[model samples]
Target: MRAVRPGSARDRPATPTVPGLLAARASADPSGVALTVHDIGSLTFEEWARRSDAAALGLIDRGLRPGDRVGLVFGENEWIDYAIAYCAAQKAGGVAVPLPAALPAGELRRLLAHSSAACLVHGEGRNPPHTGLWTATLAELRPGAGSLDDVRVRPGDAAQILYTSGTTGEPKGVVASHANLTFGCTADPRRRPLAHSRHFLHAFPIGTNAAQTMLVNALDARPGALTLPRFTAARFARLIEAYRVGTVFVVPSMAIELLNAGVREKYDLSSVLLLGSTAAALAPSVAMALTAAFPRATIVNYYTSTEAAPAQTTMVFDPARPDSVGRPASGGSLMISDGEGPVPPGTPGEVWLRSPAEPRGYDRDGDAPGKVFRDGWVRMGDIGHLDEDGYLYLLDRESDIVKSGAFKISTLRVEAALHEHPAVADVAVFGVPHPVMGSAVAAAVVRRSEVSTVELRAFLTGRLAGHELPTRWLVLPSLPKNTAGKVLKRELRTLLATPEGDDAAHSS
Candidate 1:
């Protein structure tokens, strides 16, 4: 297949639909590399567009209708197929529901049932859950001489339903319109986002908000997108060297692992021009280490949620205000409220972000949307205060604060102090039941070198208040994390609640 030369086409899609984005890119540069999964194959814009069109035709033949939900279950190694299937769903005017391969069978069933998906499209060599829905493999979607010209997909039509990581509760399906997914896309390659790089890389798992953003980046950004089947500091570093990748995206957990494993010293990572951390706030210490590791790269931390996509705060790591997550980005607005109304700077309150793109919400019935979405703003469920200069500083998740007697301790503050220790590799702080204090602070720490709880407490004695220091400690091999890389504090709470001297009890 030959690629069309850039600037050869003058007519571009007027509306930014998912299928429209691909059509525009293919028309502009059909031969340009669109996506690559390392050690796996890649597809050019032309191949992606053609194959997805064929698959869309197959879906239409199988009785898929506009507004029908199609569940897409794909394995990590099947990104190429996943991309085609995703586009095909949109092209066929169906709502795509992407699910990660690592999801448990029961949870997968729950999501498919919740979405009321009409069919399931799965990758090769995988067993889709027994959902009683019509199912087919990617290979079964054969290419054919067919056209989707009659399909009536619109920018405002529902395009996909993505489930959250369920860090706090059962995952909620988030609905995004074609416009929401393709917001800010540009037809001009020279003016496209992330134009500084030839290629950008990430290891975010599929079925996540971060991964969905990467998919949109693949569709809208100037650079070709790259990912690995799995993430390890070694392989991630090697890809940077191999591709000389300019822009890299990661979560705080990945950044911590890279620093702990000393991958920066072992690999040539200077090719990275911009390093972005998302999913969770980067601990100040970790952010500083990343800056030192990627000496030439601008370390940026992005703050947003599933409901607040395309609306986030971008911080280019500033040592003076290391804890800030930056101000509301262009086309977005940030406000801190104390339930009744907006609060003054330096006063911690619930965080709300207003989206520049169309608002997204829980794809369920009843009061769910009202609980999180109000007017056009999304409740971030986080407690933070803005500095006088307008930079936002997160104190803790509303659910993560430890209530000890009369004091409300920020778990983030404790974790940040613990991270300052030379021997501390990683740490998570949460509240555990205490008859006297109601909830006492408990800490689970992963050590790089031998370090006692007594030492850790001593280290925090000056850095934290007496009530803020952890009374219970557990030295852990590693912190538990969901696929999205957010620490599973609920699991840690269960572990900490175990009786002392029990086989499973590591608490001191």
Candidate 2:
């Protein structure tokens, strides 16, 4: 193992800080391109570093000081500017908070109030009504006229606050430090796979955890990063060809869409060397499809929550163990607990994670007082088990698991089995109320062709046992998804609960 260098010497560079890292990159390769968004042009390492520094100075001039919160409201085309602002905030010694422009007014108000943000920054031609908060556009924050010194930010200082996507409940801000954001960047380059890719491609929105991670990877990894304003399977495939992109990042939903649409067949995806999926578990069938699509690429599925980031489990796809989400990576430890304490091996329970980089807690949330964080371990609220070899297998979110009759069913397992059907395009399995059985398994499916409920059941016969099968299936034109491509189970349940055929007419 390579020893991590200490920062005790005065001559050594200030690293691990977002601005410090970018400065180092620019110093190493001034002329190399750093970021490229097709519609918004590109930025070389030198240009990005210089402009970001000026942005820091501009923020400082605007009265941003240490520990102040600055919220960035960004559109698709504003990513480059957003990246600059992200570094600038930290450089100016302020905490940066990213707010998705698509958020509802009420949600936006809640987040701003929760983070105690001092200013809101918007992009070109965009103006979101402010609820008693200072607001500015990117165009107004021009580069400074002269040289400016970088702030000395400590490793443990507040870096960024990432809001959860609210799949399980209300959105909460996750507080990360400078150390949390820069955990893996100091690893030996010779042993890093990120160094192999000449270019990285992704379409994650600016405010997302996945996107923020990609931003750091672009700076720490090899070559440049390219992005698309909007993502469609066809557009994603086209970008791969246009840029000869060698590293690909996507959610499992997009992978299924690409497979169902046969988009890869239309383009030359041979340049892709690494494909990664996060946010949710990648179904085994989808993992196999990605393998076949990018024959030379290493397929990786990473498991982590917005709260448990920086500490995660990573697995390169093994066809034999496709159900596993890999073992815990460095800088983290994993344990399965059943309230009292650690559970026996092979027994399913809440997944607890311990890492040096785990978030302190949710900011200003009333629901945080609980057993979630105990003895420095974050109870992930996810239910999973470990095999004899220590490979972790995620079943489902504890709240998402279905109790039917005398058994508990994992929605993830059912969804994974359904994905194996050739005609199934997308699927979300959940539990709906059943008077007799306590709860029954239900599924919402999107089909590529004319697939009847009977046909799907027949296809799933040997793949799943009787109790694990989804008893109630609703075939819809498409499953409702959020910006991150996670299925809106609450909306699905509401749709199914209604007696009106208006919604049912659209479903089979």
Candidate 3:
């Protein structure tokens, strides 16, 4: 593994705002395809720029002012309109809040209220949850003839506010500045991360950090972003085969599904050069499987959170160190601390990342004690350690560490071990309530073939310690996941509390 080359100032975006990135790309390559929604349509950089500029004028006509918050609600299929709305808000000098359409009405209401969004722009066929907030459809925001010269949007100005997945608790709104979003963007296509690729494919849903990153890539990278209206393993595979896509990005769940469905066998995916997995650590077993599936592709795992984005760690799959998430990339700094200070190598502690870009924070959590953001570092809320090679190995989320009868267990380790079993297609290891102990390790497993608790326990005998082995087992058809393809552990805990879950399986 080689050290990530730090980007120089000359490599930074010439115009450091989201709107500016689009403007630069349009001017440089007006006729080049910018975004292509497979089976739907494609938009050139010039078209995207002109459409967004016109939408910005419409937003201003609709009473949007500098610093006004505009909530953007769109379906997965509405990425074209979503992109325009996202840029229009910034171009009109308003902060954009991209809300997932999958969210319940009440949850949407809560987010809109929290962000204090003055207006909401939604896509076709999407009903804006009755929030009483001023609303308009993308089409209704009629294009107007005017320039956005009056609005003074600076790189330091707030650009967007995205909420967390709320897997552990209430979703917190993460606010990012223009500089934060456009940190590594460049006018020179050669400097882009995936410049070697003509097109990169991803199916990350709208309102996700992954999707937002793809949007930025559409503007900054030489590759035209290719995606589906919605992601299905079959459709994703077909897109790659059809486009001969070189770069591909997916979350661990999507990768697991693709592997489970055996899409590689059906499609010619040999054209893929880079396979990036993000949102969560890719299980080593899954990563190795991908290497075989995409023979020439470099399987990379990216680690970052909604609260700490752009600042991330990228690991090019190294069989010798499969468990390591990797050292910090893109000039970011990482440290493992135990509350008081930095911990020694090989000692697990809270992981923190410091980025050269402007730090993002909870929208309303200003200087609150015990908050994730401290100084310039964003606490990753994950337990990990740095090896002598400076590679980060994640143990588990601090909240996911199972405590049973004085023993602390890393669920990630348990899950990783379980993933090695041929019968186990996917697994989620979490803590379940225990009367004797504070909590016991429990696993919700999705199997590729029927495998009893006895067989699984036998397989895990030497792979995991006694305390780390799950006492309770639950067989599932599929794991509950959020829009971003992250497992909803809280939902798993809720399911485990049910009587049906109690009778699923148990081994003591």
Candidate 4:
């Protein structure tokens, strides 16, 4: 092991404070056009700063306490508004909680309830429905008088609590401190382009990890960079073509949609220099597809949980060795351990990381926030193993794996097989109960049209090891997906909790 050089951090120039982050960008090139939104609008560093200051002053004067949670709700095409809210929250020493615009009233209410949010600064019409129980819209919230000057924030303080996509039940507030944001970003050598780069796109929502990463990148490298109001495959292509976007980041789902949407060829995207992918594992095929689309750009695959430090691992694409998630960045250490013991090379185990940055822990009781790490390392709930070369290869989730008799099965393997089926769109696999087989592999598949379990089973027979194949296949119009597009296998397991849950239940 390299024992992670503390010297590597020193090699980089002294990083400035959070406020300096924005100011440095403004000072570097005020009219440099920090941000651009194709067909929407653009913002200079001066404009972004002015709005940030206004929102900060507004948030402070509006009685927002330091560390208070301010819900920043924006509709599509309001990236500037979201940025304003984020900077303002930082200025006021408060945290910005970005809520997805698509969530319904009930789900929105649950988010507010869970967040214990006392104040909200939201755009009109963009406020999540039924959030009135707690959230307040921004336009309607007039400054209460003089609340600034009192909202100074320290480097170690948390800047936000980005909620997970709520694919399971509720989202957990993965915490990130200001320094954590700064350190995590600059540590990754991958961001060297961002050090003194051109304007980048923040097309995704402010609430998502992608947006958060973009925010830090903006503040750290080129301040006042532009971001799209929202992300759409067509709009993404247009933005890149028009703005000469140097970097474009998105999930495989969006990338696939863009490819299939026929817009990829419609735009002159030569300006796209880096294609960054994160959130969930991008199918290897999707990685290949991205390389094919952005021939001029470097395809970077980043791995981090809402719970871990950003860019903990990153792999720039090389078709010859395309599967790695890159080496650990300068800030953290990564290892695969069996909870108590270290695993051998190529053996899948839980991915654990240790970062000087990242939340010490979460606020479990709504007070006295706690750190979630043990000793120094944090448990990242992902199941992957390091190869002899230190490249990480992901297996299915440890809990999501299906154990049938003596063989342990990979749910992802089965899902990948189902995805290859002509009629299947998406699917979730699990192990329920079995008297004889110990546990039987079960599947819930979302199909395109009339498809039967027998047909699906027949489809998988030769493709999957007989024991690895799902015993039964149930068809549905769609499988449940959380905001981040992760499948809610936990929900499926509960819903199918009966032998019905295990149509492939062990032969009693």
Identify the leading candidate in terms of TM-score.
3
Q: Residues 1-508, candidate 1: write the lDDT tens digits.
A: 1211111223224658898889999999999999999999898999999999989999988888989999999977889999999999989999999998888899889889999999999998888869999899877976555568889887778888998888898788888877777777888877888888999999999899999999989988989999999999999999999999999999999999999989888999999999999988999999999988999999999999987887899999999999999998878999999876799998989998987777676676333325677766788989999989999999999999989999999999999999999999999999989999999998889999998888888889999999998988888889999989999989888777666423433444
> Which scores greater on TM-score, model 1 or model 3?
3
TM-score per prediction, in order, is: 0.95, 0.93, 0.96, 0.80
Q: Which pairs, if any, clash in model 1?
A: 3-31
List, in order, the clash count of every candidate structure: 1, 0, 0, 14
Q: Once model 3 is optimally superposed onto the true structure by TM-score, how far is the C-alpha of residue 277 displaced, in angstroms?
A: 0.4
Residue runs of model 2 more than 4 Å from their true location after superposition: 1-15, 142-150, 187-193, 356-360, 366-370, 500-508
What is candidate 4's lDDT per residue for 1-508, written digit by digit as tens? 2212111222123544465576666665566565555556776667677667767766666666777877777765666566667777777778777777776777667776677776767776663565554454544544556655555566666667777665533567656666667774342334545542365764666577777777666655543466666567787788777767787777755665666555657888777778887876666555776777787888888887776665378888767665567678766778888867589998888888777553334434231121235544666666788989888877776667777888888776777677666566556787777889888887887665566777778888888888887765556655666555567777676767666545532221
Order by TM-score, highest first: 3, 1, 2, 4
Quick one: RMSD of model 2?
Answer: 4.2
lDDT of 2 by residue, 1-508 (tens): 1111112122213337777678878887788888888877888878888777877777777777788999888987778888888887888888899988898888888898889998887787886876798777755776555335546787767789889898888888877777778776753445444676778999998788899998888778875889989988998999998888889999988888888878767989999999999988899999999999988889999988777777789999998899999888886888998877888889999998766552445666633345565545677888999999999999999988999989989999999988888888999998888889998888888988888887787777898889877777777888888878889998878777876523552322
- Quote model 1's TM-score: 0.95
lDDT, candidate 3, 362-456, per-residue tens: 78745356457776688898999999989999999998999899898999999989999989999999998999998988899998998998889
The TM-score measured for candidate 2 stands at: 0.93
lDDT for 284 in candidate 1 is: 92
